[model samples]
Target: MSLLDRFEQAFMPNYGVPPVALARGEGTRVWDVDGKEYLDFIAGIAVSSLGHAHPALVEAVSRQVATLAHTSNLFVHEPEVLLAEKLLGLLGAPARVFLANSGTEANEAAYKLALTYGRREGRSYFVAAENGFHGRTIGALSLTGKKSIRDQFGPFPVDVRFVPYGDAEALRRAVTGDCIAVFLEPTQGEAGVVPPPEGYLRAAREICDATGALLVADEIQSAIGRTGHWFAHQADGFVPDLLTLAKGLGGGLPIGACVGFGAAGTLFGKGDHGSTFGGNPVSCAAALAVLDNLDLDHVNAVAPRLRSGLESAAHPLLKGVRGRGLWLAAVLTEPRAAEVQRAAAGAGFLVNAVQPDAVRIAPPLVVTADEIDALVTAFPKILEEAAQ
Candidate 1:
């Protein structure tokens, strides 16, 4: 039996079967089990910030695992402390960090903090944007506004009101004083890399301030130099009460963090929340390596090149490109994103059909200019094949 067959026999059907069975990867390239090489444009859904098998991440994980790996949060590890300090330093704010094992867990921690604060303040509702995605867990799913995924899991515990994305007026109207928090993604990754309109984040902040509601920015896919900034909201000159991070934080290792600023930091008391592998030394060390080696300058410089290249492609299927920095989407004129993805993979490239009309292209931050130009040159032909 092939790897796909073996996967089908052993694994659950939730994720379905991935088209390719990858065996190894280095930098921005990967080789499948059959020795087929492809340019990995998706970068493991934006998780591999430093790229596959990076020496820094390898050394850090190896050293930490050899010295100390699992601590169960019962003991304080140097790597964990240093990672938290690094994140706080990046934020340049007074905040407390709760480490977790994934983006879902981080959002769950933020949810609990919001609930605790809401209970104390007598608020009972949350406002989230339509088509926004946090994660698949219960609390995070409750905050998710996508009907196709959320409707099946409903009768959620939290009371949340959904509003149109990029519409400041809709958000302002939905976020009343009775709302506990306003959950938002700086860029809606799962909803096709949809960035909100300018001043929308500032307006949300103002609305939350006026209503005494918490502003929660879920930056799971947009942070950690993905958008050429430490945090996406920082580009708009606003700070959220709570910020959830994951994906690229550990450079591919499983780690997440929920940071609360000001009084929101003190919402969770003793015994309120905890995790067994929340701050594993190995993951923390890997995250530290990612932070130490991240190149924001490279991200800023190469982003425009990629964006302009995609936009310059004279293809009838490609409508335009959206997003900032390494996080981008090629908007299609028709619902042929899956076809485009398959065509890309066949042509020795890998991208994601984030939505029926959008193909997400988030390559590794270390991808070279030549590799980018190669993709840009091939994109027109890829779309032509997909059209067939």
Candidate 2:
């Protein structure tokens, strides 16, 4: 039996069956089990920040695993402490970090932080943007606003209010004094790379300041140069009270962080939270390598090329493109994104059908100019095939 057949027999059907069975990757390219090479535009759903098998990440992981691989929270590790310091330094703020193994766990830690803060202040509600996706876990699911995925899992443990994204007035109304926190994504990646309107984040900060509600920015899919900034909220010039990060932080290794600022940082008293493999030495070392090698300048330089190329496509099916930096979505005039995805895959490229009418294109930050040009040149033809 083939790899797909083996996968079907061994794995659950939660993710459905993926079309491609990749074997290996280098830079911006990947080869399937059959050795057909393709440009990997989706970058493992924006998790592979430095591309596959990057020397820095490989060397770091290899070295750390050789030296010291696993150390539970009972013991202190250098890589873990260094990783926390590095993340805090990047934020340019004073905060406490809770390391985890995935974005979902990071959000779950943030959820608990909010609940603790709420209990202290006698608040029982939380607010998040509509269509925003946090994760699949119970606590994170409660914070998620996508009804299709979340409604099936309810009723959740927390009371969360859903507000329209980019609507400052609606958010202002939803986040009353009883609200413990307001969760927002710098860009809603799962919502087809949707970015909030200008001043929306500023409005949220002000609202939280007045209402005494914590502002939590979920940067799982938008941080680590994905939006040409270390953190997407940096573009708006405001720091959140609680910030959750994962995806691309470890250069494809499993790692996540929940950072609490100010009083929120000290909310967790003794024995509040802990994880067994939260800060494994190898993953922390890999994350440290990713942080050291990340090129924000390159990200800013190449983002415009990707965006302008997609927007310049002359195909009738192509409506336009939206998003900042490498995290972008090609908007279509019709709801055929799934068809476009399949056609692009057949034509030796990989893209994601994030929604019915939007295809997500998030390449690695290290992707070269030539690779981008190739995608741009092929996109028109890809659209033509999908249209048929």
Candidate 3:
């Protein structure tokens, strides 16, 4: 039997089957089991910021696993403390950290932080951006504003108010004293790399402060140099009381973190929140390696180059390109974003259909100018064929 056939009978059909079975990867490229090479622009849904098999990440994980892999939460590991210090330094905030295993777990950590923050006074409500994607878990899903995903999930945990994204006024009014916090993505990745208007974040910060609500920035897709910023909330100078991170933090391995600043940092006392596998030495080591390689100067320098390459495009299929740094979207004229993604793959590129009419690009910061040129060169033809 074929590998796919054998797998179907053996494993649960959770993710069904991936279209391609990857055997190996290096830098910005991956090869399927059949040995067909493809430029990996998806970056594992924005998870592989440094690309597959980056030396730093591999070495870090290997070293940690070889030395001390799993130590229970009962013992404090040096890697965890070091990672916390690194993250706090990066954010330039006095904060406390809770490590987790995925984006959902990171948001779950944030949820607990919100609950703790809300327990004070009388606030127990949460406000989320409409069409937002938080996580699949119950608590995070409760705050996720996507109706299609939530409707099937049934009545969510508690009070969740969904408001139009990017509308500061709408968000301001929605988050009152009864609200614990507002969850927002700097650039809505799944919703198509949509960046809020300038001053919007600052305005939201003001409202949250006035109402005694915490501002939570979900940087799962936008952080870790994807947008040439350490944290997306820093773009507008908004220091969120709570911050959630995952995706690129581990370079490729799974890792997540919920960061609480100032008073929010002390919201949860001992025994309030805990995770068994979070802050595992291996994951922390991998994340530290990612940080070591992804220095601010280097990642920041790549942003303008990526923006310039996409912004100059004048094609029939493309409306415009939007986003920051290496994270961007090629807004399409048609809702056939999936077709364009497939065609790009056939043309030796790998992009994503983030929305029906937007193709998102969250390639590794290490992507070369010539590779981008290759993308730009093939882009017009890729769209033309997709048009067929």
Best candidate according to lDDT: 1
How good is model 3 by TM-score?
A: 0.96
Give the lowest summed-lDDT range of ten residues in model 1.
Answer: 169-178
The collision pairs in model 2 are: none
What candidate 2 gets wrong by more than 4 Å, as runs, is none
Stretches of candidate 3 exceeding 4 Å from the true structure: none
Mind giving the per-residue lDDT tens digits that candidate 3 earns over 1-388?
Answer: 7777777898998779656677899999998778889888788888887888988888889889999999979999899999999999998978999999999999998998888778777788899899888899999999888887788977877788999999988997788888988999888888898998999889889999899888999999889888877888888788999899999999888899999999888988889888899999999999998888886676677667767767676678888899888888999889989899889888888899888999998888777777777787778888888888
Point out the higher-scoring one by TM-score: 1 or 3. 1
Residues 42-89 of candidate 2 have per-residue lDDT tens digits of 998899999999999999999999999897999999999999999989
Candidate 1 global CA lDDT score: 0.95
Clashes of each: 0, 0, 0
Against the hidden reference, what TM-scores do the models get? 0.99, 0.99, 0.96
Q: Could you tell me which residue pairs clash in candidate 3?
A: none
Per-residue accuracy of model 1 over 201-267 as CA lDDT, tens digit each: 9999999999999999999999999999988989977999999999999889999999999999989
Worst 10 residues of 3 by lDDT: 295-304
Angstrom error at residue 128, model 3? 0.8
